[model samples]
Target: MSESVAGREAGSGIPARRLWLATTLILLIFVLLLAAYLLLRKPTEVTVPAPVAAVPAPDPAFATRVRQLEELNRSLEAEIARLGRDPSPLACPPGTARRAEARPPQTPAIA
Candidate 1:
């Protein structure tokens, strides 16, 4: 074995056994502090809200608002039915070409 590794001082001058003891003491102290903290700490109180009833009471205006919305929906459906198929492309303002009218060059069909 090498003299440095086998020597009592191990070159740092502090004995190897003393260093090992110091490390073990520090670890023991840390564990004791942790255990004390866990045992002495106060537990928090948890609050749970009461459960809601299965059926909630309806609002006074709920029925009237629903009836009014149904009537409006029916009227809109009738208006759409009256305007059958929309007339082909509404007129584009003077200078602009209609999108349907603008065509890309057609390629000749192969025999």
Candidate 2:
């Protein structure tokens, strides 16, 4: 019984030593594979776009049209202001005048 116990204590250290060696070998293989992948990987490329040119000035004809529209807008605003002050109803058109004589009220006819 004493020899068997002694043999177990002696053999216990051999399995612990084998486990430590296996763990170290696995770690070394993982590190070598990671280093090889990083070394063989291709670098990314970046492209730069060209700068845009400055915008050209507006045309003279467009400037003249804009000024004419602004003047017309001012005149219409003045006419609206004059109408607001007077508050007069607009004149009826020539063809749609109301009749001068009032018609007598007609009672409903008997059936």
> If scored against the real structure, what TM-score would every candidate get?
0.37, 0.39
Please list the Cα RMSD from the true structure of every candidate, rounded to 1 decimal place: 12.4, 12.7
* Candidate number achieving the greatest lDDT relative to the actual structure: 2
Error of 2 at 110 (Å): 99
How much lDDT does each candidate structure score?
A: 0.82, 0.92
Cα deviation of 36, candidate 2, in Å: 0.8
Model 1 residue 31 lDDT? 100
Question: Per-residue lDDT for 1-111 in model 1, tens only?
Answer: 577676745655666678999999999999999999999999999999999878868776998899999999999999788766554366566777646778855899999
Indicate the worst ten consecutive residues by lDDT in candidate 2.
87-96
Model 1 segments more than 4 A misplaced: 1-14, 56-111
Let me know the TM-score candidate 1 reaches against the reference structure. Answer: 0.37
Top candidate on TM-score is 2
Model 2 per-residue lDDT tens digits across residues 43-104 = 89999899999988999999999999999999999999999888567666677676769675
